[model samples]
Target: MTAKLEKTLGAVSLWGIAVGLVISGEYFGWSYGWGISGTLGFLVTTIIVAAMYTCFIFSFTELTTAIPHAGGPFAYSRRAFGEKGGLIAGLATLIEFVFAPPAIAMAIGAYLNVQYPDLDPKIAAVGAYIVFMTLNILGVKLAAMFELCVTILAVIELLVFMGVVAPGFAISNFVANGWAGSNEFSFGTLSAIFAAIPFAIWFFLAIEGAAMAAEEAKDPQRTIPKAYIAGILTLVVLALGVMIFAGGAGDWSKLSGINDPLPQAMKMVVGHNSNWLHMLVWIGLFGLIASFHGIILGYSRQFFALSRAGYLPKSLSTLSRFKTPHRAILAGGVIGIIAIFSDGVVNLQGMSLTAAMITIAVFGAIVMYIMSMLSLFKLRRSEPNLNRTYRAPFYPIVPGIALVLAVLCLIAMVWFNQVITLIFLAMMFVGYVYFSMTKHQRENAEEDLMLVGDNH
Candidate 1:
């Protein structure tokens, strides 16, 4: 049976869905990666990542425009490769969603602890998880509305980040740290670019998130692509601004080991004694919380979509009278709690899981994109008159380039992060086996029903 969709999200609302909570992670991840890979010149490293992010989003936008389904990756896989394919995609996507909340909640707790010092970070993290859970369970519309508030706060914080750091601009910090071991021209410089790619790709994720709410979006065909393009462009600009301001505010050398870079940059530039630094830090903290919420919103919708497709448990598929997938939301929250506890025990066992999950999430997305591009090509040849409000520009060329870039990124992730990539693929393999068995049983049951119908 086709699932009923509630029109709780519109074009602007869908845009708000992505803008809210991802900024914190995006900024933090990019800064951390750049700081770690200190060998590459900041500009070269930044450009490499920007290219990956741009191509990844371009691929996702093509698929989203074609399907515009709530399932996102899972739905795309099913459409491309059928039930078993959907199950594998669903599992990979689930890993990302389930692990994200606790990671973010822990981050919230960590940021709070920076200020309070005395606040039990664990309890604070759990508290943040509970609050976010309550918001999600309340329903998607309410979640979207809450997300709107967070998005506004995040944008203001970003503006504050730019305003505070732009003044302290210094070009030397960037140039001083020339390409790692570079004697004019060498592979070491090339290595730096390759090394920085994954972290860069991580920053620009969730660009396709707007598509998860496509069914609910007002004129989804138009809205999803517009939001997709707008959200990605905004984040791209934000990322470049952060890179410039951070590199300028202080030597990248000193920024290491600090969790709140924007505030730290402000304090270094304007003096911690000033009220402005304090205010920006407070705002930065809120932006982090908002980003967490936005991710949860996008991830849960994918879960809901997968469950409804019968690849996940039927219970998770059931929507409430309010038209929200309460069970799936709760399931995701439970996973978050598990992640939080796991993080507490180890340096970041759960956090590692979150990272691994993202790697696999992109892997799955790339695979789906290749298939979706093929589907687009197939449709063009077979179903020429399909009602598509938006066709990918340059036809096969844009989509073709997108597909090639996605494959390249996937290869790089697998090559560099092999162990984690293997674990993720193993998880997907297990899901595939389980799904195949389930399908066999389901077909048998259907046959029995047909026999009974004939006897009657």
Candidate 2:
């Protein structure tokens, strides 16, 4: 039977996908994790990280506009590097997404527990996970619609919190008492920033969602670049607002002890009324669910792409009636179920932080992105005749600056969180072995099946 064509998504829908980045647990975790360093420090650090995020998005947007395929980083790496390169990119993405859902689910559980002190956190997490997984299996069109709605609500919630909280400005919490429970700056503050980098990135990583859906994007070359710019700009605006709101609400020094720093800022303006906190919690819950939905959808496409390229089970590459990669969606659900147990590894905050570290370990994605950006220069030299639509402004200089910033972020994440960094590396090594063994076995099986068919 002929395969059904996949539906194309518009630029506005893609922007919704981009905005989903802000509601993630990583964003909250970063604000909380670094809130210890005072508001000014958080602002300074976020600017550096945001700059890196912007460059990464631009480089990725250039590639997506150039190759507009379903594979996201998998397609880019495959084209630029080859099968092995593609496999690594695909594997790193799997690791990243595998850890993401549970982190979000667990965060929901944590917040819910605070609201309903009697509720079991584990139960809350499991229920949210099941709900999110169901939403994903239903397919992308539905998921995008959900994303569009949640993105709007979440953005409005962010702005409301900022506006409400901004008026309660106390210059006290803005000072430097150190967010950490330490005495001096020494290597500790630097170490905390390193630890913070991975989770900090979680808020910014899915700007490539539009790219992953490139094959299903109407006029992808035009739509994808537009989505990238819009998405990144949206993130920058919200992120900057978050920093400003957090800074203005109270003294930066006192922010160190607050775990849910955003909500804490919200409370300063709205007061400690249970009704107000409940409303904010519900909004936060929406943010968590929306983030999980986007992560699963984006990563499943990467899984489908890898399988099509022979790096994963061919079943995962199979499409359903809706042209969705149903098998990959199922595989991701199973992996996510197991990853949910990582919540058992620690409380909500620890799992979220660990997931973030695993995410940045995709130095491979950054590496591939840098190569793709450099390839822009090479392609200009080699394939000047290739059709050009939207070129990254400033050409070599923009990409060059982006490459340097990405390198710095990677180094910083690695230096501070060497343990989690090693965990991420270990996971990648396991993926390499699995890829090698599976590829060899599949090739041998195919040969045997062909021989038997011929003999018959």
- Best model number under TM-score: 1
What TM-score, to 2 decimals, does candidate 2 have?
A: 0.86
Off by over 4 Å in 1: 39-42, 55-59, 178-185, 344-375, 378-382, 440-456
Question: Residue by residue across 312-419, what tens digits does model 2's lDDT show?
Answer: 777776787667887787787776666656545644335453344335434444544555555455556654554557777777777777778767767776676566
Task: Give me the candidate number with maximum lDDT.
Answer: 2
Find the 10 residues in a row with the least total lDDT in model 2: 447-456
Clash tally, candidates in order: 3, 7
For residues 31-138, write the lDDT of model 1, one tens digit per residue. 545543552444565675566456556656656666667777666655555556556556766665555556557666666776788997668877886787678767
RMSD list, candidates in order: 4.8, 5.5
Give the C-alpha miss distance for residue 446 in model 1, angstroms.
12
Q: What lDDT is reached at residue 337 by model 1? A: 75
lDDT (0-100) at residue 186 of candidate 1? 63
